[model samples]
Target: MNQPESSKSLFLGGAAKATAASREKYVPRMGEESALEEVLVEDVAPVRISAFVGLLVAISSFTAAVAKPMLVLPVLAIALCLFALRKHDGRTKPVGTLAARIGLVLACLFGSTGFFVHHLKSRTLGNQAVYFARQYLELAARGEESLAIELQKTKPNRQVATMQLNEAYSQDESAMEQLENFRSGAYVDVKKAGLDTEWELDRRPRVFQKYGREKVDTYWRDPSGKFNGVIQVELEWSPAYEGEEADWHVSLFQVERELIVAPSVL
Candidate 1:
């Protein structure tokens, strides 16, 4: 009886040891699996060329916003996709790794610069346009139909040259001559109404402001129209403020003008 009892006890002890070992192994395996499941998708994701993409997205959106109402949705979609790409794990890759990084950086730099540049220009043009429009409206209100007609003929639009000639005349005849010789690009500095010192602009038109009114440069090119039509004008303007000294010179307000066409017409 004693021998049988000893054997039973030994067998039971061995089974208990085996069960403990199995439990230990199983616990670690389960824990490892749970840990893997919790790992984030972004943490181990690959790199992508997203900075340039973001810039392009922004540019496209801006252009669409300027050009047509229908372009907004597509532009917005592109922008959203770019935002996602930027947030993705792949962004770092395109910016940091491989020869493609150079192109990506260039694209980012130029694209960003281009977007802001266009925006500034548009805003400038819009403000000028608004100012002109107000003047025209006031004339019309006073029953100065002739002047209003002239304003309409000269106001800026997709055909900016016409607006240039329309707005070219200054009280000073010398100024008019100066304008007729102007050769700058269309650009404007837009700022908060009171903060004229701060330059801001847009690359498109505005109903309340101006659109193609921002001049950068002027050159004559024949439009598809009547042959030998002398009704041509050229214009140029830019937002480049002429500043000198680290902090001594006051902001120069240059409204220079020029006519590339020998016979500029309204």
Candidate 2:
């Protein structure tokens, strides 16, 4: 008896896709020679190396949040992904095409976030330190030694001000040494010159982390004023949770005592 046409296809038996060569494939009739030889053949496109590498670099773009120099990571990753996408030939499904696109997305996400944060934090933090340094000097100029010393301290350190500041300054040699550094040298000159001394930034503020704490240094120089020196105002970042910013406070007030006397000034 002849089999019905409904039961003829090789894959699904009925209405299933089958090649004309799908005669008696794996289960052939008594004397069938032609079988499903080409039924299981598959075509795969070559995977692009650059696309995969772009994905990796994109993942590393997260480091961009740590510093400005790391901004290049995401930029490079985006370039690679774009190049790989442009290389697509349309006809074939490029193996790494999806990976490249995903990489591009990740790079953009991390890179932009980091860029915004770096600039925002740097500017605000630097300005804060500069202002704090100026106020500290102003207090010193007014002979408020206790207040100046207090401003130079971290909040917690300043809170332990139970005893008289004069006695405390003499006792906490370590803290006193730092406070003394601020009270003398450039501090004295700036105070003698009055509070009108303009604060000139020596260079771009430097940001780094030490002892697991974020630190920023704002270097101030006033060569045109009686101070004629560079002083570094250091601020430390303290962590705050629940979407609040990390609080920053004075950690150190250091004056660069190196002297520079220009003939033009004299």
TM-score of each model, in listed order: 0.28, 0.61
lDDT of each model, Cα atoms only?
0.37, 0.73
Off by over 4 Å in 1: 1-96, 154-266
Model 2 misplaced stretches (Cα beyond 4 Å)? 1-44, 49-53, 56-76, 79-83, 86-91, 159-163, 167-184, 196-204, 222-224, 241-249, 257-266
What is the lDDT for 120 in model 1?
70
Across 1-266, the per-residue lDDT of candidate 1 in tens digits comes to 35688899999999999988665434332244365333333334464444445444444443443543425434444444454444333313333133233434443544455556657755665455434433322333344322333332222222334345344445548545544433121111111112212121212332222363334221111133221112111222333345522111101122323547677587
Cα lDDT, model 1, residue 99: 26
Q: What tens digits encode model 2's per-residue C-alpha lDDT throughout 41-105? A: 12236678889999999999999999778999999999999988875444557788899999999
Residue 14 of model 1, lDDT score: 99
Residue 202 lDDT, candidate 2, scale 0-100 = 88
In candidate 1 the C-alpha lDDT for residue 34 amounts to 64
TM-score of candidate 1 to 2 decimals: 0.28
